[model samples]
Target: MEERDKQLLKMIRKQSEEGMSLLIDEYGGAIKAICSNVLRNYDAGIVQDAMQETVIRLWQKLSQRFQVKKNLRAYIYQTARNCALDYLRKYQRHSETDFEGVEDMMQDVSTDVEREFSRKHNERIVHEVIKEMEEPDRTIFILRFFYYETVKVIAETVHLKEDNVESRIRRGKKKLKAELLRRGVLNE
Candidate 1:
């Protein structure tokens, strides 16, 4: 939370429209990126829906909890991630049967390229593992790894009070690592 962020919070708390606009303008790209990553496998409509939900959540929560010492982009990233995750969970429940053959289908792909091909293939496996993650976790991993958002900002974005964000990130990392290991993409 820099002085500028504190000022923004004050303005937002006062319900200043300009403050809201500034917040959106500054943080929108990061939010969209996280949402896009989390909902990568879903339709574009769902991804857009998730992004809107995340922005709405940020608007609703910002005035009450935003801190000047936090990173705004990270907060937006986490929020986007959580919203994406929630959407995915509901989606999975509704389409569990449709996803039944996913594992078997993944196992059947065979390519003759080794070395560079194997590396690219492993990268694809990593992407698939990320796609399989439940919403917020998938979102969080992308924000933390792909975008390099700070934990403090991530906590604020997700409305988790910092410590929770750290814990969630740790767990998310472990889960991703395990998934990669299971795919034989990571060495023990």
Candidate 2:
């Protein structure tokens, strides 16, 4: 942690309103981005609710006696992810397609229940594979597929050239498809 983050931690440990405000001022964008990325399948209201829930969870956790002192950013990111996933679980909203580019990964099922089950299972597998991916690839995949960000926006966010972003996304999809195939989850 930097000196600035240390100061923020100190303030947040006090559980004061100003401390919470400082925390938000420092990490609000990241929190919102995490929530938006995780809850992209849902509406703005759901994302906003998850963001608020993340903030509340942060406040509760940071004020604890055994709160995280180091790697505060990771904790915040994990909290945002958890809160968004909780909303997903609460509402049982699933993505309509198997991400943006992998629509053919799922085979056509005869029954709606089987289709839903297959989609949820395949989605879980894809998420697991993406989580195991390396840095720039993982971040690029999440931004591109989960957040539905354009290649140019992804390039700016990840500080890469547009071509580089496109290639990374392509490679990420290839790797994902391979993983799904290896796991016998793909239609092919």
Candidate 3:
């Protein structure tokens, strides 16, 4: 760990206000980026909401545990990812989605029962598979493929070099494709 990371841990373990402030100041941008990427389909308001919830959860987790088992940044990244997914699930199940709902997704899709069911099922599997992926790759894959976000936008949002983002996306796509093929979900 870096010197700053050790200090941050000390401050967190001590439960100091300045520590929380510093933590948010340092990681807020990354958390927002993750949430924004994860909730790309949603409006800004939902992204902001997810980001706020992520910070709160992080604060609570640190306050309660006072000990981090792994790298702090990675832990925060995972927290943000899980928090955004939870928000996404909650929004799907409960939020009013007249503007962008299941209907919107299905609007252009075929009406074939077998194809539709298989597609949705495979999509769910893909999501689950993506969730199980490691950091950076998971975020990169979702931002690139699922959201169809531009490489520049993803690089800026995730604070990675544009070429790095592209390479990661390439590898992520290849990995996802292999996994899907292995699972018999991807014919090609």
The superposed Cα distance between candidate 2 and the true structure at residue 82, in angstroms, equals 0.3
Each candidate structure's TM-score, on Cα atoms with residue i matched to residue i, is 0.53, 0.55, 0.55
| Clashes per candidate, residues 3 or more apart or on different chains | 7, 0, 0
> What would the per-residue lDDT of candidate 1 be over residues 29-105, giving only the tens digit for each residue?
77777777777778989988988898778778886765534565556667788999998887877777686778775
Candidate scoring better on lDDT of 1 and 3 = 3
**Model 3 worst lDDT window (10 residues):** 94-103
lDDT of 2 at 48: 92
**Model 2 agreement with the true structure over 67-107: per-residue lDDT tens digits:** 57566766877888999999988777345432754545444
**Which regions of candidate 3 fall more than 4 Å away from where they truly are?**
95-188
The candidate 1 region of ten consecutive residues with least summed lDDT is: 107-116
lDDT of 3 at 77: 75
| Backbone collision tally, model 3 | 0
Q: Whose lDDT is higher: candidate 1's or candidate 2's? A: 2
- lDDT (CA) per prediction: 0.76, 0.80, 0.81
lDDT of 1 at 33: 73
How accurate locally is residue 137 in candidate 3, as Cα lDDT from 0 to 100?
78
Which pairs of residues clash in candidate 2, taking residues 3 or more apart in a chain or in different chains?
none
